[model samples]
Target: MELKPIKTRKIYEEIVEQIRELVVRGELKPGDKLPSERDLVERLKVSRASIREALSALEMMGLLEVRSGEGTFMRRLKPESVIAPLAWMLSIEKGTVQELLEVRKILEVQAAKLAAQRAQADDLRELEDALENMRQEIVNPELGGEKADLQFHYAITRATDNKILILIMDAISDMMQQMLKTSREKLYQGKYTPNILYSEHAQIYEAIKRKDPKQASEYILEHLSGVEEELNSHIE
Candidate 1:
């Protein structure tokens, strides 16, 4: 309700930023209806067109929902919805593949450690299932095992039971999948075999299953660091 007038070339982006800031500040909450376009126009000193554009963008980002006759209401923000635009942009940026791997190392190493400490029986079962799927996919020439490999990593994050970490994982899922596929292809072309990949994942799983956080972290780091080295060698 304390909106400011827009004074920029990109009026719509500014409007979106202001609205997003309001949401971040806990002023506008989920299920709260936004002011009408005419009211927003008066408040932001922007044209109705700009307001509409901003609102439309927010809707597309899953931040707002427009009812047929009930105006626009803020949607419950999901981690994936909030960070999806960043994922899309990163997907298009050049020379980010290595950076993505770096991020994976940071997030996944800690994920493995926390999973060892916090994983429940269900979490262990999920990890085991993913590992078994990876083992089965090793002999399936067409399947490539990338999906199972990604699932294995996702299961580890779920075991951690940390919502923010899980949110970050969900947000970068597409990029992660692409990274897996690309790196696997590169490694397979050289000396890495599907069985070798399966073994690495199995070791990580065993470490987590034993509730050995240190061993789990070491195994995961070793696996990822090797892959990172392989990726860098190809890139260079």
Candidate 2:
């Protein structure tokens, strides 16, 4: 509820920054209603147009939800919603798919290690559910397990309990999913069978469940490296 007056020429960007800072400081949270435009203008000593522009940008960033006649409220952040804008830009970038996997190896390997150390019972349940879903997908190829694969990784990030790490995962989730879908298709067409993929995931899950951080990290790295190798083969 602390609204400072804006003195900068880029008034809207300043507004966005302040609001974002509030969020980072835990002042604003999901479902909290923002001040009215009139209220914001007066509080920030800015024009209504500046307030509107900032609000629009925040909405686009998936940070706010503007319901009809209900004012604007802080949105519950979802990986897909938060990263949609960034995903669009990354989708057009050269060699982004390869880069995405490289980033994934870095993030996910550490995430697996942390998850092995910190995962709670609820986190274990989610990981198990995702693994079960993967098994089901393998049994019935029509079901498609790509979603389960993504969910498993997301559960690992959640288990880490690091907000910044979780946010970075959200930022890349869309592109990650696209990469998974394409890579899996190419891999399946090659020597990599669906069962092989499922086995690799299962091994990682077992390592985490055993609370063996070293094993979990190793398993995940090996799995990711294999996927990268397969994808490279197709590209080459």
Superposition error at 29 for model 2 (Å): 16
TM-score against truth, every candidate:
0.82, 0.67
Pairing residues by index, what is the TM-score of model 2? 0.67
lDDT of 1: 0.86
Candidate 2: the clashing residue pairs are none
Which candidate has the highest TM-score of all? Answer: 1
Check candidate 1 and list the clashing pairs: none
Query: What is the C-alpha lDDT profile of model 2 across 1-236, one tens digit per residue?
Result: 79898989988878987987898799999999999998998899999999998899888878899999999999998865655444434544536667878998989999999999999999999999998999898779998778999999999999999887887887777777777787778989887887998899889889999999999999999999998888889889
lDDT of 1 at 114: 98
Enumerate clash totals for all models, in the order shown.
Answer: 0, 0
List RMSD in Å for every model shown: 3.2, 6.1
What TM-score does candidate 1 get on C-alpha atoms? 0.82
